[model samples]
Target: MSTLDAWTHGEHTHDGTTHPVYRRGTGPGVVVIHEIPGMTPEFLAFADEVVEAGFTVVLPHLFGTPGRPVGAGYVLDTVRRVCVSNEFTKLATGVTTPLAGWLRSLARELHAELGGPGVGALGMCFTGGFALAMMVDTAVVAPVLAQPSAPFPVGPTRSRDVNLSPEDLAVVKERAAGGCQVMGLRYRQDPAVGQRFETLAHELGDAFVRVEFPGRKHSTLTLHRQQEAVDRVLGFLDEKLRA
Candidate 1:
């Protein structure tokens, strides 16, 4: 059986759209949204680590083939799909992906069931900013962005944009004012991340916790997984969701 086959599978429906969710572990909830190439082995492994750390972890499959390796061809294929998907806001600045509402709904449901302070969400790569968007729901207490590359990082505006519409961003800022902190990780030289960190700092102020590493590493929990980043995220989840 595939790795996902061993996990409890279900569909999270919101706004008439549904996506597959693979869940495991027990305790407070933590939703792990995968990158462009879907839930690869590395992503699953990272989710497993979150589970072992005592959170009921849910892995949502957004795009690409689950369990596939991140080869150049696989990456390109997934990129094509995401670039064309209406759920994503590729090449568009100052717009939050519509898919974030669905994700926030899922987080609300998870928190309702798990019964914690709230739930934790960690998004990597293409899905990274989704966690930030979900924060508008208030139930998402711990939102971690791992190399959040959205709006395609195409031009100057796209590069600096946080992908959150003004209204949604206002809500996120309000949440930050209420003591919610968002964590972000990226390599200093990763062009894909652009200047989102700077935007996040300006918007979130002291509530934005940025964890930066040196070199050109892209993925924080996979591909170029940084042990320190992983540990920091786990600790943040514990502090926000468990305590």
Candidate 2:
């Protein structure tokens, strides 16, 4: 069952673009990265728990699927949106992606508002590895990569890529060398994340902890639905944010 709590919704700006932000509670700040379907109710419910745990939560809806205010038939709409929302032709080639830049701008905004030097960041599923990339900024001190989607390359090579860009991986390596801990979770039966992705778990050395639930699958977030997991996440935030 979800916590079913309401969040204080607001908007923030970055790179001349505005993004939706849902938040509540008051204390240290934590950024909650959404999954594939964007900022759905379930994801917000999870953020609510983070707020209730006593930290202010900031969740960004990066992709502007504007005018989607209602959750009516959300499951189906989300499916179409995630799987095949756009069908336009690619007229141009090799356009530099803005994801990494946008993420950094968001980190700056949160750090400024929190009146702090560092803040916590979490990325889930499609956005899982994003948190690690955010560590490129020293302000992103504690990073959580939950059920991180396997980094797969596009096209023929098809080898499991860590998904993060080479430059960003270098940043993470630096953070790990500086003693920052990275934690992650994934289901045992998730075909999306194979032994290859496990290389990421090994790459972090002892700094990374991957917890496995034997019967769990890809949707571990919705499977166990454990209150204790939320507690542990909060504990992690408390430990990282306090000192």
Best by TM-score: 1
List model 1 lDDT by residue over 1-243, tens digit each: 136766898899998999999999999999999997888888888888888899899888889888887899999988988888899888887789989989999999999998879999988888889999999898899999999998778888889898899999999999998899999999999999999999999999999998999998799788898899999999999999878
Give the poorly placed runs of model 2, Cα more than 4 Å off. 1-5, 63-97, 150-159
> On residues 89-131, what C-alpha lDDT tens digit does candidate 2 reach at each position?
0111121124556666777777888865478889876567677
- Model 1 residue runs over 4 Å out of place are none
Indicate the residue-level lDDT of 129 in model 1.
Answer: 92
Indicate the residue-level lDDT of 76 in model 2: 52
Prediction 2 global C-alpha lDDT: 0.64
lDDT of each: 0.90, 0.64
